[model samples]
Target: MKVAADHRSGNSFLDFLLSFVADCSKFQSGYVALIGKPNVGKSTLLNGIIGQKLSIVTAKPQTTRHRILGICSGPNYQMILYDTPGVITKQMHKLDELMMKSVRSATINSDCLLLIADICHPPEQVLGTLDEGAVNLIKSKPTLLVLNKKDKVKQSEIQKKQEWYEKNSGMDEVIPVSAKFGLGIEEVKQWLVSKLPLGPAYYPRDIVSEHQERFFVSEIFREKIFQLYREEIPYCSQVNVVRYVEREAPAKDFIEIEILVEKESQKAILLGKEGKALKTLATAARLDIEDFVDRKCYLEIKVKVKEDWRKNEELLEHFGYSGKIASASL
Candidate 1:
């Protein structure tokens, strides 16, 4: 029994593939990278464009560690939207340095930059681009300044945000948007389409992302972990999807995922008394993945300790962090 990797055995395969690749083309559509400070709605913007919660969102800062590449496919185009980790403002650990490098690299690799700034933040707070002197780099790029959460503030106040942004950042093109409410998103789309050059598609038409199913499943679980433990355990943890099997005989699918923490204390924090927390996290994550895949997903979870993989270079590479496009490209 031979198998096919490129060819799908089911109907709608070719149509999906062609559509996926066709969407990535600039003659049709193109890619854009959203970069800005944490909690500024980058993930919200990506989800808003793709109309799905592909990237996890939370109120806590530094919620995103990896670059979420979400492809939005339309009739004649697609946008390979990348949601990167927010740029670190203060001096951070080695891991922080690598993540910030990834964000900066995304800024350069992208065709257009949508620098998000929350309208709800202080009027004097630095919004859009980071104030750490990376401002000029973004200013030189074909950029759009998105004032997200406009609905959270008064319309007149949002205009004040626009004026404040223009005076501070030299950003002439500031567009107010409410990502949660689906306002001003189409304008952002039109703005992005205008900036990208016409070219052949970069990916197949049917594909929504370059990552496989396991990556997304693990990410969805990670979101639950982050939401639950947050400063207690999230940044010090990672999700490893060990096994994913599609069963034709049983007409079912199962996934084995591992959650790694940095220490025994952290492990305790995750499991809780009689493993209640772990059970809760797994249940929520399992439901989310099941919905995403539209199947009954059997999830196996194990909690382990890796002791600071974030700072260890070899371990980071082993975990597939061989310079995510940010470090590799720039």
Candidate 2:
């Protein structure tokens, strides 16, 4: 009986030692920045890779203002994805400059890069789209040229574009994918895993992102603005969550939001005739917020004129554009 008990203890110790060795030897983790021009589906690919809508997506260009972190963790790896603002070569306003700075910050922090391109568009040099400040940094890193929107083009066109990027883009690899349709996404993931350095997991295995709930709530409202409005309305607008309260089950959560515009004319347009437009926006935003948070909530929206806020560097920094990329707009 004593020998039998000793044998059982030895077997248990061996199992524990093997488990620890497997966990230590197999882990891979690193930061990856998704870089591209406006409307190139960077956010779409991020959402596809993370398998969740962490970054907001729209048909309009320059929808993402800040650098959002989307964390995807598997059993053996954790990929921290930076869904960055579209890098614009032209710096028109203080906000645009700050956004480019955000892009640079993400690029510097990331271990590798995903330089996305639109296959539907002509085969232009991907590095040419990044600002001069970020070009050298991108070149220094291992970059994968993701030719997105492959679903929109024919198979032959896809092959031609893929070959073109491989020949001219100077990227480590060229992957043609339809981020919107979930095609070639696994290849993208596999490439990322290979590039990521071997290390311990950066986040818990079940966690998907590090952003606060309020940041995403504001993004949801901003996305509705982009979808429902036209012309300069979405571009000139900013959404901020003023107050968020979590209540008990009998009472719904409470959220108060503000939308900032540059002019009274823009405010009037946002409100629409007799406030009907704002009501439509609120209803749409509220529904999406409920879905995002997985709970019912009361939403209050107000439109204010900030008078060229985009040009105001002080205000732009206050909105979390300069350095604190993930700060929730208070």
Candidate 3:
């Protein structure tokens, strides 16, 4: 079965012919869920497949707290990729539980599942990463066991691991990939296109995501926090864009953001000596935001204390953990 080629490529004569053929033949579109344990390159794979960084990535695990939607559109197909938070066996806080719910919701909605795993480590049963709730959900759908980070492992090891998963893991297919280097991504995409049902495009071809601009702005700040800070500080922190004002011309766009921490000490640490650390983070975030938005803007940041915010159900629900997220407004 032929699938959509990379959408980012130029429109050559051959490409145009292929596009015409795809239009006349069949068009496939559907949602794909990226699921795996922490730091297993699920986000990386999504970004690579979408050919854009829709989800925030860091060396730290659990950097992605929300289910980020990345839309990839070719002439014939549109794949809506859900980059979800990593699955954890232990729920340390209400936030973790909410994140798990988000994962399960993504699984329910997806047409197919990509279960990513780090290839450097020994292969574990796919069932081990999923909870009881997800096992049935995954089994009912077409699931692919993706062994990511293949570049870090030997060719021999890759074969061994692939064999191990194909034999032991109860998945429809197994494919080794390096999400960071874009290896074997096309094969993965083709597999998804084969699994996706035939349908019309769910969104316009040009748009990459339905999320508002402010949502990405907030995520940029959150990603920077995870990168700049160490230990509990990043985990305890939550970044929100309280206010965003777009200006016409001479005036730059104004964005007022706030960071929530659990304690005064954590707030102080975020503030740093003479508030230097916060300033540094703001500068880094603003640069990325400017690049992402393709314009310049004035950024204002404030740090606040929200005691036990992670454990607060009402607050977590408000944060879009349990319901639809109007990211800009929230």
As for lDDT, the candidate ahead, 1 or 2, is 2
- Model 3 lDDT per residue over 101-123, tens place: 99999999999999888989877
As for candidate 3, its clashing pairs are none
Error of 3 at 296 (Å): 0.6
RMSD of 1: 6.5
Off by over 4 Å in 2: 1-24, 131-133, 325-330
What are the models' TM-scores?
0.85, 0.91, 0.90
Order candidates by TM-score, high to low. Answer: 2, 3, 1
Residue-level lDDT of model 1, residues 1-330, one tens digit each, is: 123643555555666666656644436555687987888899999999887778888778888877789888766566788899986767446678767777877777787788888788886445434654466667677888898999888888988878888777666488999998899999988888777766656777677788777878878898898788857587888788888888764476878877778899999999999999999998999888989988887787788888876788666655655553211100
What overall lDDT goes with each candidate model? 0.78, 0.88, 0.88
lDDT of 2 by residue, 136-243 (tens): 898888889999999999999999989988899889999999999999999999999998888778787787888778989999999999999999999999888888
Ten residues in sequence with the least summed lDDT for candidate 3: 1-10
